[model samples]
Target chain A: MATVRAALVQEASAQFTSRQPLVLVVDDDPDVRASLQDMFESVSLETAVFESTAEMLQHGIPDRPCCLVLDLRLPGTGGLEFQAQLREMNQFVPIVFITGHADVATSVRAMKAGAIDFLPKPFRQQELLDVVSHALRTEGEKHRDGGERNTVRRLGESLTPRETDVLRGVARGLLNKQIAYELGITEITVKMHRSSAGRKLKSISVADMLRKIDLLGI
Target chain B: MATVRAALVQEASAQFTSRQPLVLVVDDDPDVRASLQDMFESVSLETAVFESTAEMLQHGIPDRPCCLVLDLRLPGTGGLEFQAQLREMNQFVPIVFITGHADVATSVRAMKAGAIDFLPKPFRQQELLDVVSHALRTEGEKHRDGGERNTVRRLGESLTPRETDVLRGVARGLLNKQIAYELGITEITVKMHRSSAGRKLKSISVADMLRKIDLLGI
Candidate 1:
């Protein structure tokens, strides 16, 4: 397995560049890791091969847009346990698991743990590529949403309770008059709150503020 | 299989009086279909089970909001062929596949054909329920978008090509001045196009028009 990891990294160094999305490949079997690296690199994705879960954690994961192609049978920590650890660390990067011993119980558990897809061993290159692409796209969307939500949270952290209420109403697509009526305030007061909230958030338009709120899902 | 179909229909009939979402379970195995019907019914979803592809096609899928839990190893047409047929008919209903022999190639192929998820045989009841819920939610979103798009298309069909172009630009988050600059037209002409397009689409504001356009992904 160690040989497999070294060989995969060597091969990936020759084939993939930093421009492509990085994929971490974790499997105990050397052959499996090498094959996966070859397959993903063929699609122009950077691949990092790890022989075990310990190695993966020790090597440290990159903060770039990436995903995992993990094998269920690992040496140190099993795939399912590793998945739990990753979730505990709040690493929501998408994962696609490959397993030789296919079973309903394991697959179901994996899906419930937020796996993007699970493939049995001896998969075709196209099959792997398609799943990887889907995982990458899903991760990208999620990462973008996370960034927007962070921005929204930072912007909203300083708002007063009343102003936050007004912001929620605005985010829900309420008009000024409607918000004023709902809040039992005059339209002029509602306008004042809106302007103040906008200034505090550094947003120029209601739409931009709403977009941020939408990202926050509030 | 026939017994499963009967049980599913009975379950569906019982639930149809309420507003629960319906699910169509297509499989050749009686036990599999029966299990799925029980699982779905437990979660307050209607289930209609069929023994074969021909039976499903003969019954004619309902226009109501629904999804399919298809079996990969069907008697005649099989899962992949049925999926292709559904795609050919332009049906975008989400599917969750059940397979006795799960493999990477088969799962990937099903996903590419728009399956929301796949579970191997002997799956947990909660597993099926979770995937079904996700699939229904996704299909619901798509249906809502499709309804909005249909209304927009009906209205946009009456517009001239230039008006449609301006409408698209508005949907793409462009201002009238920016659209005019991009199209090499006067802002007045752009406003005229926007107003005409909005009136034709029965929209009151640029925001509504933009929402419709976003729903249509144009």
Candidate 2:
């Protein structure tokens, strides 16, 4: 009984330690990475620092619940391009972009690409920590609920070509009769397609369906 | 027919005139407000400048779609508090916060509170314009969407007590069986509640549901 109790305690401890979210810090500057690592650690997080985006990609990101702390300027592929690549790969980990100047155009573009937060250079330690904490917590929650998310994404992708056409028309605020006229189908047929598409996307309302389509940017 | 044609011409002219979105500039400093008004008008946007929040609020906001250009420090209910009030009143017009000092803590707090962007004192003209343009465009899109986002927010707010409990547990990474046991409900019932909450929130997946919850900090 004592041995069994000891084993249970060990298992609980392992689970607790494993639950600490990991953060990947990718910046060319060693000092920045070190400081961020220290800050994240102080908050009971585990962090890995990479000097370049190349180094980060080479190491192959771990499957552990994680987020990327990325610098806006990097060697080779630049930050913006890297972000574009991540989006193309459907890697939706929350990103906190760090930059020297908060250029308005660049910031707008980054936000449109789904970056969670942006911090200008010479930012306060607490500001960085706060954003990082928020980002990691967000990523951790995503990891926890990834199963349902992937299922939805997959279901959205599996939509038939005709259903997708119907969806785009719906998103344009087309009425059911209008969609049927455009698609050369009966109104009843339009309703059937719409219902099927919504079921696959796990969406119940037309507005919800439109929002999911927007999120996928399709 | 002639009168109708003349009225149509006048309406077309008004549409052209209203192409440039109006901006409400709120700052206590006359020079700053005037300078901003001049700058924005040069870019063809309409500007209404005020020296205080009270003045702007009293004058009543513009009837057309608009965003606020706010100074962090004001006479009475300051920028931060005004922002809080705006959110409480569910007036989600985008805000661009300007400050004379580079207060990181305040800036982060403002960003977390949904300020579209933050600009420090001595910002370049282009920087200010860039942020304003983005804010205006975002606000215009929201208006054009006919308040679809408000529907999402309202649905998110309507989660039942049991659903909220299940959502928190799901965010914390509990499996369905685990949540069922924790809530003392059948697993089928847990599934029903989870699906219902997700539907109500217009979330296609658990991750999306969690993201909405995190955004609302519920």
Candidate 3:
């Protein structure tokens, strides 16, 4: 009985941990939000909808691969203002804007602010679907790339400060002599740090070591 | 009949003129090019292979969605220089680099120069295929976007010089009075220019006109 219960718990936990990719729809109109939700659902995509920025903010961001479908003319904190807020918080989630009243100036600001795409309302359903998919894929890449950098950073934590300096030099395409001179260390010492860093990071070649260090922001 | 003969000629011309999407593989290694060609063929994508940049250059760019799969360590010109050459010629084709010897410095330079993904040799076949598809999609978007910008530019040419100045001011989110003051013109003149610009572009709303002007580089 205990074993069966544990198996059931494990299955439930697995389902809970593995999230479905999502699209967050933020629009003031009920019809717009509902239509968007249904459209995403037709493609087997999950979505959460909000009528205002305040409500959307309360929901927080999900960890799964997701993109925002923001209506430009939202109540209170307009789409551009909310986008600025997201940027100030250093969140780089992909966003697609939908507006009934499309302006060149506002759209340019939205694009400059890093929006994925802008859809003028009465837009074809297929166009929105295409942009949604593109935004999700772009967000997925950012997440994966971020995770990769984190792994590289973890590996970097094992390096000594001297080893870190040596790794940076190599990553910059500097020779051991240049690194040694820059650090006021002997060439032999620089070599030792490079080797030590390599071994600690399990890197097999200068190229591989440099790749990791660069990813780690060395 | 004349119609039947015309139809036959039209079909033949269509077959010759309608080109398929292509991946251009440029590498010094004959084997690398061959393998890449086979991989693309497996996915029903077309490929053209070359042993050097000089040979690749001779063919010129195709008027279709395409990307270059370049080897970083070519015998002459090398990948980076060749990328520079393409840029100098006002070509912005997407490039994906593959190298057996990927060092941090060269890979970084390759990325900074806008090479897509840098795959080390011994990468999975699926990885290459995925990246190739991504590069093709990216190139496809660039072409589409360029066409969109061109259309916007053509629309912009309809505006009179004063209208163009007023469009710029409004695109900057400046009020009519502010634009008038800045341009040393009366508020009424600024309004007149804005209205004339709107009428010429057939823009129905402020947002719509602003979007076009922004794309037109106002």
Candidate 4:
């Protein structure tokens, strides 16, 4: 468990210092891509520019917290359609849509589909940068949550069956005698199993054990 | 606890039957207000029309799950400004913005402020209805979640001090002997308090008690 936790901590620090947060741009126009690339680069943010969804998908997103700056109208598949496809694939990269021509219906559709922000043509540079910052922060939170859940699950997998039963009874507010009666074991045995389980999980208190159990859905 | 739960259930049913879902409309033009009222009423929805934010505030929203259909431009306060005020007042009624001239910046701002949808003028009737339905459903979920949190708090308040101590220890996976040592009570006394707390909270298992304790943030 310590090793796993250490690895996660190291990975997080490595990401912060060694790897830069990325901004993906998918626009058919070369000028727009170049200008956007410059804009993101000016702020010390790494960016990857592509001409279309096909080109972006071919390269795939790197293993880092990232967001997409996509044009609404592309060469073949529209931005909305690409968003739907990503949802189907369970790729929840936050998206900010840029459009040359904006209508209410399309904007509503894009927003409803979970686009981070919709910007019509000639949008302010600062506005796009602010939205991208928000998107990256959101991605960071999501990654941390996922990592914590995985850690909890791994810790849960370390307990013995009897230890699990004893801890489960404790989490539910049951007395040792009551747990023993239910499991047809001695109250002393129940206590032993619970303490052993607590040490294994490194739970300092009943509340911590309860939380980990809840996180593990046990 | 039972009485509180029952009252909440009764209140929910009362809201569903006696009180129909409401759609509040705020528009400067009387014609727009009248047309929106007519549209909502056609679907058996009750509506209150107002010429401005002041008029709506004066009337006050009824105690029910509801949404707002707001015009972007109003006489006194703009739609965006009114939305901000509602947020500050902790009034989170879902909003659907309607505008004659749609701009990306304004639409983005509205959506960021938690507006349900933004529709430009000459929007399809069905589109407006669909958005209203979604907004009402969102409001219903928020109300139910609030009710549940309150119920959990009320249940937490019912525990005696000793009972709460024993339960908190149990929720953290503490053995009866350990909890008794900490509280300077006999193990038998700890067991008695555990059962008593479980009975009061109607907790069938340790997992259930753990969840209730977590919800109470103990």
Candidate 5:
């Protein structure tokens, strides 16, 4: 557990330099940590090996594609408990668990809790890497570049409530005439608001406005 | 294989009746197919097992979240060959392989080719299920309701190229003046185009147009 903390810093530093899927290994065994690190690194994947969940928490979750490789048993908060805590905190990183002893109960509980994969000690290197690869690829689809979403959110915020209503209707493929009729407003009013919204959003044409809005998911 | 194919048809019918993730198992063994189908169905996942990739192809790819469980050695096209063929045909599905006797070379090759998990026969049911769970969860993110994307595409096709350029600039957060200058057009012309495009798209306001476009991903 102690040696895991020491290696944690090195893993964090290496992770910042590359845009690869991250594997966060939390194990008490220094040898297991080292072996997992080497295996992941061999395939050009980055890893952050921690001895304890607390130590891993100090650095916070890395803001990139990553998966957790947890040992079933730990010093303070065991793998299962930490997993539950993460869920409570609304953190959704995929987790793969490893343990020396195997039990049907532990495996079933882990899977029910959404653990990605569980392996007994002395697991095959290729087998573990393959599971990690799948985890990362799956998580990749969800790591939607947080910064971009924020900017889009801010842009949408500039719209008036009435404008937003029209926007939603239009985005959902409703005709302006239909939107106005449904909202008990004149089509002319809808056109005027649409024009104003484009001006505020800095769009130059209808296509441009729609394209921008679609991308922003406004 | 014959029994597997029979079960596959049943699985396909069940999958069509619901939105569960499809686990396509390509194995030559009947016992393997029946066991895998029961395993997946128990957890509410749909299984489409085939004795060979060719037989699997006959069913075509199901239109839903899916992962492939491949047995490395098979008649006609082997697991690896079918994997490559799928790639050539532009199909990308998460794959898990099962083999009676495993070796380092084959495991490495399979993982490198993007197989999700590799298991030796007599694998724990939990292990296979966990891997399948990970693959399915990951694929879920990439599945964005195909029908919606199609509708969006059709709406986008209605826009003119010039309108699309304007929309792209707007989506990128550019100002009308900036877009006009970038496109060598006057700001007034940009406004007129935007307004007309809005009318053509049936969006009453600029915000409406932008919203519609965003949904269409133009």
Candidate 6:
């Protein structure tokens, strides 16, 4: 196990410089770790394998979008307990649990606590890969240009009530006349509000305004 | 089953006149439905019981905050399949699955597809009630005053960039001078922006501004 851990760390460190999405695996069984390492690496995903939650915590979470593939029945702290611990520590890492001893109650508990997906052991390689891709994509969305989001949010905060209503209607694909009818305003007023909103948001096109509205998440 | 369903409908119709959150139950066994109906009503909760998804659909979803308590293995459409069908129809009612045939795969699938809770048969009454309360609470959040949300969002959309920054800092509990320092502006400028934002939002107090910020869900 020591030699396997050392080899895994060396391989992971070598791949870390590439800044690719990471998949962290924690299983007491060395063979399972090796198999997962090979499987994730086959899809060009970097992996850091550990024998227990303690070891993974010791190494600390990588500063990258990553998902944890955890074994349900670990040596010391179980996967569910470790998940709670991470939550208490405010580490919101996505987790996918695998277990040979699958039970409905435990699976329900894990899902209720926000495990991304739970897979019974001897699962398909494709299933695991697809779930990992989904988890990574969710994490990536959170990590995307924070500065850009702040700017968009600030711009969204700059509209008047009428301008916001016009833009939101536009975002919903409403025509200016339809917006006017909905708001009980004239079409000319709708146009004025639309153009004024565009100016305030510094957006040149309807598509750009739509994108900004999406960013506001209304 | 027809007689049992009729009795259930008659009882439910009598209770529907009162405006209360409804709990819809669909289970094949008459005994189970009766038990659930009694349990829910014992706590003063309104319930509509059905033997299958077809029957529930025919009865129609209640026009208020509600949740579905579905049996996993029905004679016709199963619980998980019915959940998918509901999503297809865009009903989005929260669901809690109760099944005698407990399995990991199905539980995980149900949870992944957005089930509020999955319970194996012969579960505790309190556990089921707690989960139902949670589901109803979630549904209630969505049904909250849409007009108020629109008003708050429009007010949020009316803040200038600097005013937004100042207010966001305030919402995070930062002092006015600290916000000024962070924004590379003077303390007086921070106060000016804050006052302007308060007036624009029609929020007379810091607490009101904070509530508005929360409503914007930033």
Off by over 4 Å in 6: A1-19, A145-218, B1-19, B145-218
Q: Report the lDDT tens digits of candidate 2 across residue range A1-218.
A: 99779667755644443266788888988888888999989988889999887887888766556778889998887778888887887777678789885665576456656777777788788977777788777666766565444445656877998988888777776778989999999999988988998888988544457667766566
DockQ of each: 0.15, 0.06, 0.01, 0.41, 0.07, 0.23
Could you tell me which 10 consecutive residues in candidate 3 chain B have the lowest summed lDDT?
Answer: B10-19
lDDT of 5 by residue, A7-72 (tens): 676456544523567889999999989988998899888889999999999989877788999999
Can you write out model 2's per-residue Cα lDDT over B125-156, one digit (the tens) per residue?
89889988887886677565544444455576
Specify the highest-DockQ model's number. Answer: 4
Better by TM-score, candidate 6 or 2 = 6
- Give the winner by DockQ: 3 or 5: 5
The TM-score of candidate 3 is 0.45
What is candidate 1's CA lDDT for residue B58?
Answer: 97
Model 6 in CAPRI terms: which quality?
incorrect
lDDT of 4 by residue, A1-76 (tens): 9988987886675545324579999999999999999999999888999999998989976757799999999989
Candidate 1 clashing pairs?
none
Which candidate tops TM-score? 4
lDDT of 4 by residue, B1-218 (tens): 99879778866754453245789999999998898899989988888999999999998867677999999998899999999999998898899999998877788779878888899888898999998988787777777776666666666777898888887788667899999999999999999999888887777876677777777887
Candidates in order, TM-scores: namely 0.63, 0.56, 0.45, 0.76, 0.51, 0.63
Q: State the C-alpha lDDT per candidate.
A: 0.77, 0.77, 0.79, 0.85, 0.78, 0.85
The segments of candidate 3 whose C-alpha lies over 4 angstroms from its true place after superposition are A1-20, A173-178, A186-188, B1-218
When 3 and 5 are scored with lDDT, the better candidate is: 3
lDDT of 5 by residue, B9-90 (tens): 8556544532568899999999999999999999988788899999999999876788999998998999989999998888
Better of 1 and 3 by TM-score: 1
